[model samples]
Target chain A: MKTQRSRGMTPAWAVAALAISAGMMVVTGCHKKTSTPPAAMAPTESAAAPTATISADPLSIDLGQAVVLNWRTTNASSVSIDGIGNVQVNGTQTVSPSSSTNFHLVAKGDGGTTDASVRVTVRVPVTPTAPSGEGDMGSDALFHSHVQDIFFDYDSYELRSDAQASVTAAAAYLNANPNIKVLIGGYCDDRGSAEFNITLGENRANAAKQALVAAGVPAGRIRVVSYGKERQFCTEETESCWQQNRRDQFSIDR
Target chain B: MKASRQGLVFTTFSTLLALSILPAAHGQDWNVLETGKSASASTRLAAADLKPTGGAADEAKHTFDATLYADLASAGLFDLVSKSQNPQATPGSQSEMNLGQWAAAPASAAYVAFGNFAAQNGKIVVNGFLDDAKNAQYPQIFTKLYNQDDSAEGARQAAHEFADDIILRLAGTAGIAETKIFYTKKDGLNKEIWMMDYDGANQHQLTHLGAISIGPRVSPDNSRIAFSTLDKNGFQIKVYSLLLGRIVAFSSVGGTNLSPAWAPSGQQLAFSSSRTGDPEIWVSDPAGSLAHRITSFAGPDVSPTWNPKTGAQIAWVSGRSGLPQIYIMDADGSGVIRLTDGGYASSPSWSPNGQFLAFAWDRKYGPGAPGGQDIYVMEIATKKWIQLTHDIGRCDFPSWSPDGRHVVFANDPDGRAEHTRVMSMLADGTQKRALTGAGADMPNWSWK
Candidate 1:
C-alpha cells in the first residue's frame, strides 16, 4: 500500500489542489494520509453545511396556467421540494396550482440542513356579471338547475314517468319566460351505430318536444337537434354511465 | 423485337384520341378481374420508377412512382411486385425495356408498367405504358399520355390518371385512383367536412363552419356535396357546391332535417325530415324545392340512400317497429320491404350495381354481448348477409366505391369519438387500411 501510494503521489497532489480550488472538499480525502494535516479537516467540516434557494418564474398565474419553479442548492447531498417530494439538487419544475401555494425546498448535508421557499399566487377568475333585466331566474345557471336533462331507456324514446315530470317542469319554465327560446339536444350512449343513434337521438328530442307541446309549450318556441353518440356525457362502459348519456338536454337557444 | 413492333410513341397532340381508342380495343377482358381473388391468382405486375428527363423532373419523379405503385396495388386486381425484386433499370420506352429480365428470376412479373416523366414549359408530362412481359410479338397493352401543371400534385394527378387507364384496359372497370372521399373531421367541439384523395392523400379541410357537420354525400356529378349540420335554426341539410367552394343556399323545410342522399340522376335528393310533425322520408329537388313526403310511417325514417344503378329504390333506416332496422321502398315510397328483420341496422348504402346494401349492423346489440357493431353487406333479393368487418372495431357508415369493389367506413377501435378513424377495405373485408389518423368519420366516396 505504501509503495502504490508513493507511486501515485504526483497525480494525487494535482487532483487535491484542483479540488481545493474548485471548493470541492470530498476529493481532498484522496491524499489525506500522504501529506494532509488535521487542521485542513476544519474547513471541510464547516463547508458541509448546505444552502438552498428557490424562485418561481412570474410568481403568480391565473387558474389553469402553470408556473415554473427553479431551485438551486450548494453543498447538499439530498434535496426535496414540499409538494413535489424528492428532486435533483438543481433543477426546474412546472406546476399548476389551484390555489396559492408555497414551494418549500429542503437541502441536507453532513454539516447541517438548510431550507428555502417561494410563494406562488394563483388568481381565480371572476365570473362575468350576468346581463340585466332577467335577474337570477333568467340566467343560464338557474335555467340549467331548474330545467334538468331527462334520461331515457336504452333503445327506447318513450318518456318515462320521471322524464314526463321533467318535461312538465321545463314546459312551465318556458311558459313563465315566454320570450326565452329553448333548444333540446338528444344524445345517446356509444353502444350502437352512430347513424342509428342519430335518428334515435332525434326521436328522443322530438319525444321531449311533443311532451312539452302537450304540456302547453308552443312548438315554435322549441327547436331540436340530435347530437347522436358524437358527444358523450360519460364515457365509461358501465350501465350507470351509459344511462347518464342517453338523455335530452335542454339549453337556451340564444 | 422488330423495329415496327416497338410500341413507343411521343405525341404532342391528340392525347384524348389515343385514350379513347385504346380502352375500346382492350376493355373486353376486365370482367375476368374479379374482387376477392387470391393474390396467387392475380396477375403479377411490376411498376418501374419513372425515368426523369430533366432536372426538375427528378423532383417530381418520386411522387409519380409512389402514387402509381399505390394506385395499382390498391386496385385489388393485380398482385404487385415489390420494388426490392424489381430490376435496377428504369425503362422510359419500349425500346429501352428488356422484358426477358422482368419475366425471369426474382421479379417473374407477368406484366411491367414503365413510364417517362418530363417537365416542359410549366407542364408535367408522363408517357406511361404497360407491356406483356411474356409476349414479345404483341407486348404493348395500353399507352397513355398525361400532361398537367409542373408540380408535385400535378405529377401525382398524372400518375393517378395513368394508373386508372391501365386498370381500365386490364380489368374492364374504372379505377378509383383519381376519386375523392369527403368526410367529417372533429375540430375542437365542432365537426367540419374534409376531403382527401381516394388513396388518402392531399387531405384538406373543406368547411370552417365552427359548427357540427356530419353525413356528407357527394352528388353523382361530383359538383356538390350534401351534408347535415347544426345551425341557429336546428339540424338542417345543406348543400356545399364544390365548384363554388362554399355552402349554397338550400331552402329549409323547417323542423329537423338530416341525411341528404343524392339520386344517380343528380336531379333529386332523398332525406329524412321532421317538418310534418314526425321524421319521415322526403324527396326534394336539388335546391330543396318541390319537397314531398314519401314515408308517412309512425316512427322516424332516416338515412335514405338511393339505388345508384336504377335510382328506382331507396334503402333507408326506419324505427317503425321498436328498434331501428333497414328497409327499402320504391322511389315514390311504395313497395316497402324490410331488409333487416331484427338487430340494429343503419346507414344503408346501396352498391353501384344496385344489387346489395352495405350498412352498419349490431346483430346482437346488447350489453356484454360478443356481437359488436360492424359493417355488413346484404343482398337485397336473397336477404343473405355477409359480415365484412369481424371484430377489429365498431365500424359504421360504410360507403361503397363507385366501382362497387371497395367500402370506406368509420371505425372506433377504442370506443371513443376522439379516437375514431376513417377506414377503407375491399368489399370482401380484405386489405383493411386506415385512411385518416383519427377524429374523422362519415366517409363518402365521390361518384365517378
Candidate 2:
C-alpha cells in the first residue's frame, strides 16, 4: 500500500485484467438512481389522522400591518399554505393581509390529509381628518368610529335581536346628541338585482329609521338612504363577507 | 360547409325602382319576414371594413369599421361572416359592389353591408349600403347617408345608425342602435348613472354625484335621464339633462323616492314614494308643478312603469295581496286589473306597443321553492304569461327595447358572486346575449 508509485513495474497482464474488471463494475454502476422522490401522498384515507394548526401571531391586524403565521403539523410529509406556497412541515410565514383572509393548510402524511384554516382580520384605519362636508364631518367621523352598524340577515329587512339592540343603543345616542342629524345608509350584500336591492336596501334603512323613531328620536332628524348593493363593504365571495356587507351604517350627513 | 338558406330571400323584386327614388321605396319590403321567433338558421351576413373616402383622421374610419362589425355581430339574427372570410374589398358605394363574390362558396354571405366614411370640415359624412348578395339588378336593399360630428365617437354613432338601418332592412324589425341603455355602473362604493350605446359602446358616466343611483329612465326624446340618486338627506328622483350634461330641475317628492318612469308624452313622470305613510305610486309633471297619487293600496306599492307608446296605461307592483304582483291600470289608477298570479313579482315594464308586460317573477314562491327568480312576459289581452328566463341567475329589472322585439334586463349570471350584468334577449327567450360586463346593473332601454 505504501509503494503506490511503483505499480507500473508490477505486471502488464495483471494491469490489463484489473482494468477490464474495473470497467465492468463501472458500467454496472451507471444505473442512475431515480431523480424524483416519490410524489407527496395525498393522504386520502384517514386524513384526519394528520392534524395541523395555523396560528397567527396576531388574530387581528391594522390594514397595513403584517401577521406571522406559525404552523405545526403531526404526521405530515408535506405542508402547503393557502396564499403561501408549499413549505416545511413546521415553519412560520409573515403575511400582510389587506383584508380578512383565511390561511388554509393542506397537511399530507402516510395516514391521510387534514385541512386547517386561520383567519386574519384587517381593520381599516379611521381617517378623522378627511374632509367630510361641514362640521357635520366631526360628528360623522366620530359616529363612524364609535357607533356600531346594525347587521341584518340575508334578504331580510326586519331587525334581528342584535340589530334591535344596536338600534336601541343608537336611539339613546341620537336622543343625547340632539344637534347631530343622522343618515342611516342601508346596504345589501352583492346578491340579487340592484333594482330590487334598491328597494330592499330602502326597506332596511327605513326599518332602522322607524326603529329609531319608535325609540323616541324625532322622525325629522333621521334621514334614510339605500345604497343597495352599490356600496359593498366586502367584495369577497363568502357568506361571512357578505354578511358584513348587509348592514346599516349610521352617519351624520348634516 | 353547406350554406344555410333559412331566411326568406326577397329575390323576386321584379320591379326595379329608379335609383334616384330608391331611398323612398327601400322601406317597403325586407328580404326576411318576421316569423315572430328566431330563424331556423341564422342569416349569413358579411360587412366590409368601411373605406375611408373622406379626409378624416385614420382613427375615425377604424372605429367606424370596428363598431359596425361589432354591432352587426351583436344583432343576434346574423351569423356574421368573419372579416378574414370576407373578400378583401371595401365597397365604397352600393353601385360598385360585386355581389357574385359575396354569394360564392366559402363566402356564401346572404347579405353584405358596405360603407364609406369621410371626416372633413368638422363633419363626418357616411354612406352606408346593404345589399342582397343573390340579387343582381337592384342588389341595394338599403342605403343611408349620415352627417355627424367629425370625431371618433361621432363616426361610431354614424356607424350605429347605418347598422340599425341594415338590421331593420333584414330583420323586419327596427334596430336598437340609435337608442341608449341607461344603467348604473358600480365604482367602489359609489354607483352612478351611466349611458352607453345599445351595443355597449362608448360607456361614459352621465352623473358625477359621487353617490348611489339607479333606475335611470331616459326620456323618449333622449333629452333627459330620470334617475334616483342618494343625496345628503335621502334618495330623490333626479333628472340629468343630456343637452346640458348636469342634474337639472326634477320634481322633489318628499320622503324616499325611487323607480322613476318617464312618460312617452315627455310631460309626466311616475315614481314610488313612501312620503304618504306607505309606499305608493305617484305621478307628476316633469316640472314637479304638482303631484297626485296613482295608487292608494294599504300595503306597499312601488315600481311604476308606463307604456312607452301610449303613456295612458301604467303597470306597477302592489303588495296588498300579501305577496307582490304586477297590476296595470289607467295612468289615473282606474280599471285596475291584476296581471300576474299569486306569486312574488315586481318591476313590470310595458312593451312599446302596449301589448305585453315584462316583469320579474318567482312563480314558485314559498318554502323550498325549486326555481330561481325568472323574467316573465304577460300578454295584456289573455292575462297569460310565459317565463322568458329559467334559472338564469336571479333575472330582474326587465326593460323592453324600443322596437318591442327584445327585452333588456339585469341578471346575476354568476350566482353566488353577487355581481350582476345587463343582458338582452328576444321577447320569446331566445338569443340571450349579455349586453354589459359585470357590475353594470338595472339597464333601462331608451325609447326610439
Candidate 3:
C-alpha cells in the first residue's frame, strides 16, 4: 500500500518541480547585465572606487555600533548605502567597523564597473540582543498577544508615520508565521453620525491591509471587516473611550 | 355658558381626533402657505366673508382661519395664501381688496370673510365666510363660533375649533395640522424619539442618549411626548415637551418602567412597570409622581393606549392568557376586559376616533410557509378583525393617523437579518406603502 501511494505522489512531485524550474528561468531572464570594468581598474571588495559601491550587510543589527569591511581599490567616484544599516566608508574605500553592522556596499570606477561585498558585526545597545518573540509565546499565545491596532489622525484613517511603524511590526510577525491566517476588524469611535462612521471604519481596515502587503506580508493571510462604531468597548461620551474604540483588532483562525 | 364652551372644546378635540389616521395617498399636492411667495386671492377676504352657508358656521370660521390654512396646507391638499403677501401691512391687519386683481390671481378657489364679533353669556361669538363672489356682499358660505363659557383660555383650541368647521365644509373632513403624533426612530445605535406632521413630513428626532430608546406616546393636546429609554438604572419612562424641547424621566423604584399611555385630558399617563417583580399597568401624573398600581395579572402586561371616545378606558397587551393578547380596562385599571382572543397580539395603537385598535399579531408559521407576524385592526364596536398584511414578512408598531383612515408602522418579517422599513397601510388593510428606504424600524406615526 505504501509503494502504491508513493507511486501516486510521484507525478505530483514531478509536476511541482517542473513548475518551479520554469518560474526560476523566467526570473533569470529578467536580470540586466552589469558591465565589468577593465582588469587594471578592478577594485577589491574593501576599496571605494570613484564609481558607486554596492552596499550589503546582515539582515539583523544591534544598535549604536561600528562595522568594518575589507576591500582593495580606491578613487571611488560615489558611494551610497541602501537598506536598514549604519555604515561609514573610509578613505581606504572599505566599510569602517561599527558596534553592530551588516550591510552590502559596492564601489564603482569611473568606467561604471562595480565591486561589491557584505560586512556584519554586532552592535548591542541598552537591551540584550534576543531572537524574535514569536517562539516564546507559542503560536496560539503569540496570536493573542499580537496587538493589531490601526491608529487614526483625528477622525481620519489616513496613514501617518506612527501608523506605519505599527503595521511594519505586524507585517514582520506575520511573515514569520506561515500557518496562521488573520482577520483585520476595523472600528471607529462615536463622534460623527452612525452611517458615516461605518464606511470610515471599512477604509481603516483596508488601509492596514494595504500596509501589510507593502511590507512583504502575503495578501492571502489577511481579511478585512469593519464594525463601524457598532461594538464600542466603552459607552462613555469621553475622548478616552472614543480613542480606544477607534482601533483595529486582528483575530487569527487556528 | 361653561357647558357650551366645554362643548366647543370637545368639538375641537374631536376634530383633532379626525386628523388622527389619514391614509397614504400618492402625489398629494400639499398647499403650503408659501412663506416668501405671493399670497392666494383668498387672503383678501375677512374670516366672516370666507365662510359658506349658515351664520353659525361663519362664527366658527372666523375663529380658526389660521388653523384651517395650516392644517389643510400641511395635509398636502389646500394651498395657503401667504400671510405675508402684503409685507407692509400689520400682522393683525387685513389687506384692502383689489377685486379685479384678486379674481385674476392663480387660486383654484378663493375665501373672503366679513363678520360681527359679540360677547354673549360671558362667552364670545364670531361669524365667518368663504366668498368666491366678486363682491363681499354676496358670500358663498357662512360659519359660526360661539363660546358660552370663559373657562377655556387657549387660542390654539379656538383656532382648531374654527378650522375644523372650515375643513368639513371645504374638504369634507377634519384638518390635521393642529394635531400631532409622537414616534420613535433608530438613530444610529440608539433609538430616538420624534414627532411630526401626519403626512410623514416635518420629522425631527428628540432624544440623543448613548443608550437604546423605545415606544413613544403623544398627549391629546399634542404638547408632550412620552417615551422609554435606557439609563443607568435600566429602562425608564420619560416625558418630552414638544414646545420646550425638554425631557422629564421617571425612574423605576423596583422594576423597569416602559410603554407610557397618555390620559385623554393630558393630565396623567399610564405605563407598565416591573417594579413589583412582573410587568403590571400603573398610572402616574404627568409629573411622574403619585403612582398607583392598576393591574394584578400574573404575566407581563404592556402596550397601553387610551380610548379617547371612552370616558376613562384603555387598551393594552396582556400575556395572562398564555400568549400575548389585547385587553381593555378602565382608566384606573379596573374592570378588565379581553379584546383579542385568537393568537399573540402586542403593540396596541388605538385609533383617534376610538373606533378601532391596530396591533401586531403573530401567525402560526414563519414567513413563506404560511403564517407570520402581521398587522391587524379590530373594530371596537363590532369586534370585527381585519388582517392588514399577509406575505412572507412580519409587521409591528402600528400607529394611527388622526383621521382614522390610515395606519403607519414598521415591518421586519425576516427578523433582524434584513433591513427594517417604515410602512403604511389603509385602515381597511389596503394600499400598503414603504416610506423609509431600508434598515429602519419601530415607526411612530405623528398626528400632526
Candidate 4:
C-alpha cells in the first residue's frame, strides 16, 4: 500500500509543480493566489487533499483605507490567516493595514496541508509644502501666520513690553517683504460700550502702527481700522479672553 | 363766569400742547416744560377695539385695534387701560360710546378712544374719536377720519395717525408710533442696513451689500440713510436714497470713514475721517462735496451726533484725554468742551429738545470691573446725569426717539457668544424691551 501511495504521489508532485507555475502567473497579473491542484491521491485514501485560493478585492489601497481579503478552501477542516488568526473555510475579512503586507493563509485537512498568499500594497499620501521666504511673502495666509497680533491692556492703547516685541518682529517681516502692504485692524473686548470702543480700538491699532514705523516699517504701507466691540475675538467673560479681544490684528492688504 | 374760567384754562393747556408747532427757537423749551411734568400726571386712557363696519375684513380690524392699543401704551404719556377692564360695549363713534362706563370701576379711564373701520370699493375708511370721560358737557376732544387702501397696512397706518393725534393732545409731543428705526442686522459674516417700525414691526432689509455696514443714521428729511460700509477701497460712508430705493453716489475720500450723522437742516453731514492721517471730525455737504476737516487732533475723534434742536452744536467721542469721552463742540469744531469727567463715555445722542444727551458710559471700566457699561442721559446744561440702564448688559448707541420720551440702544448680554440685541426703553429706564433679535446693532431712530 505504501509503495502504491508513493507512486500515486509522484504524478501528483509533477501536477503540483505545473499548478504552482500557473499560480505564479496569476499572482503576477493581479496579486492573487491560486492553490496548487489537489494531489492525485490513491483511490483507497480516506480523504482528498485540500485546495485553497485567496485574493484581495482591491490589491492596493491608500493609507488609512481598508481592503477586503477573500479566501476559499475545499476539503479543509481548519483554515487560518497569518495576521488574522483562524477564519471560516470560505469567507472574507476586511483589514486596514498601516503598511504594505503579505496575507498568508494555511489550510489543514486529513489529506494534506495547503497554503496561499496575497500581497496588499498601501500607498502613503504626499503632503504639499508651503512656499516660504521673500518671494513667496505675497500670500496673505503666509503673511498673517508670520506676523502676530499684539494685545493691549484693558481700555488702554499703550503698547506693553510684550506687545513691543511683537511689533518689532512684525516690522522685521514687513521690511523683509517691502512690496507687501499690511492692514492693522484694532479690536476690543465686549466689556465697554461699542461706540467708545471704536475710538479705543483705533487708538490701539495706531499705537501698533506707530511702533512698527519706529521699527522702520513704512507708515504708508500700513492701513488701520477699528472694529470696536462690533467684532470680538473671544466672548468669554474671563480676563484672558478679554485680552485676546483687545488686540491689533495684522493681515495682508490684498 | 365759572364756565368761562374753565374754558380759559383749557385754552392755556391747548397752547402748551401746540408749542411744538412753533418756530425752532420757541420749540427749544418744549422738552423742558414737558420733562418737568410728573409721569404720575399721565392721563388714564382706554382704547376700545375697532368695530368692523360694512365689508370690513376681520384681519384688518384686528390689525387696527392691536396697533392702536400698542401705540397708546408705548407712548410713555398714557396709563393704558387693560382690554379686560374695558366696558362690554365697543363704541365705533361718539354716539355709540358710553363715557360713563369707561370712567367708572375697573377702567376709570380719563379719556376713551373708540373707532370704527370700514372697507368699501378697495378703500379703507376709519372714524376715530377721543372723548373726555368725565366732562359730559364737552366730552369730545377730537375726531379723526382716515381713508386709505383696503389692506392691513392701511389699517395700521390709520391707527397710527389716530394714536398720534391722541398723544399730541394729551402729551404735548409728536407721537413716535409713525416713526421708523434704522439699524444693522448681521447677515452671514456681514451686517446690512435694516429698517423697522418704532414698535419693532415691519422689519425689512434696506441694503443688500454683503459687507459690514453699521452706524446707520437716517437723514432729517427721511429721504436718505448714511452708513459706514467696507468696500474695495476701504471703510467709507455710503448713502441709501429711500426715494430711489438704491445707493446714491457719494464721494469716497481715501481713508477710513465712519459714523455719518446728519445735521437737522438736512444739508450737512458730520463724520469721522482718517483722510488727513489721523481720525478727526469732518463735515461735508449732503452730496459729499466741499468736504473739510473740522478737528485736527492727535487722537481719534469719532461718532459725531448733532444737536437736532439747535443744529449748531456737535457732540462726538474723542480719545484725546486717554480713554474716550463725550465732547461737544460748535458745528464748525470750535469751543470744544468735555462732558464726561471720567471712565469710558461715547455715542452721544442729542435729544430733540436739545435739553439732554443720552450716551453710553462705563463708570468703572477695567479688568473684572464691578459695574457694566450702561446708558445715561445727561442734562447738557447742569451736567447731572441719570443712568438709564443698570447692569442689564453692555448697552451702547442710545438714540433718542423723535419725541425725546424714549431711547433705543444696542445691548450685548451674552458674554462669549457675542449675541447682541437692539433694545428700547423709556428715558427713565422703565418698560425696557428688545426691539430686534440677536445680531442687531446700532439702532438709529428716525427724525419723524
Model 3 residue runs over 4 Å out of place are A1-254, B1-166, B171-173, B365-369, B413-418, B430-435, B445-448
TM-score of model 4 (CA atoms): 0.74
Docking class of 1: acceptable
Worst 10-residue lDDT window, candidate 2 chain B = B12-21
Question: How far out, in Å, is residue A30 in model 1?
Answer: 95
What digit string (tens of lDDT, one per residue) describes model 4 on residues A143-224? 7766899888887889999988888878877877666788899888867655556667777888998898999989989888
**Model 1 alpha-carbon drift over 4 Å, by segment:** A1-146, A168-182, A218-221, A251-254, B1-42, B54-57
- lDDT: which candidate is best? 1
**Looking at the true structure's interface, with contacts defined as alpha carbon pairs within 8 Å between chains A and B, what fraction does model 2 recover?**
0.17
Native contacts present in each candidate (fraction): 0.42, 0.17, 0.00, 0.36
Instruction: Compare candidates 1 and 3 on DockQ and give the better one.
Output: 1
Candidate 4's displacement at residue B333, Å, is 1.6
Predicted structure 3: clash tally:
97
Write candidate 4's Cα lDDT for B144-254 as tens digits: 898878787788888889999998887677788899999999998899999999989888999998998989999999999999887654568999999999999889577
Q: What DockQ does each listed candidate score?
A: 0.28, 0.12, 0.01, 0.23
Predicted candidate 1, C-alpha RMSD: 20.4
Q: Which stretches of candidate 4 lie over 4 Å from their true place?
A: A1-146, B1-42, B55-57, B232-234, B416-418
Q: Is candidate 1 or candidate 3 better by TM-score?
A: 1
lDDT: the better of candidates 1 and 4: 1
Ranking by DockQ: 1, 4, 2, 3
Q: Compared with the true structure, what per-residue lDDT tens digits does model 3 show for residues B1-448?
A: 3222111101121222211222223111111111111222233332322323322433433434444454444333234545444222111212333433434444323654333344445554444334454655654564465343322222235545566566566556666545544455666767677654443444566777756666777777777778777653345788888788787655456445777888777788888776665567888888778988889866557778888666478898775665567888888777888887665577888887776788887635221234466787666654545566777376788887776656788776454422667776656455567666455555665544
Q: What is the per-residue lDDT of model 2 for residues B66-86, given as tens digits with 9 covering 90 to 100?
A: 888877776666778988888
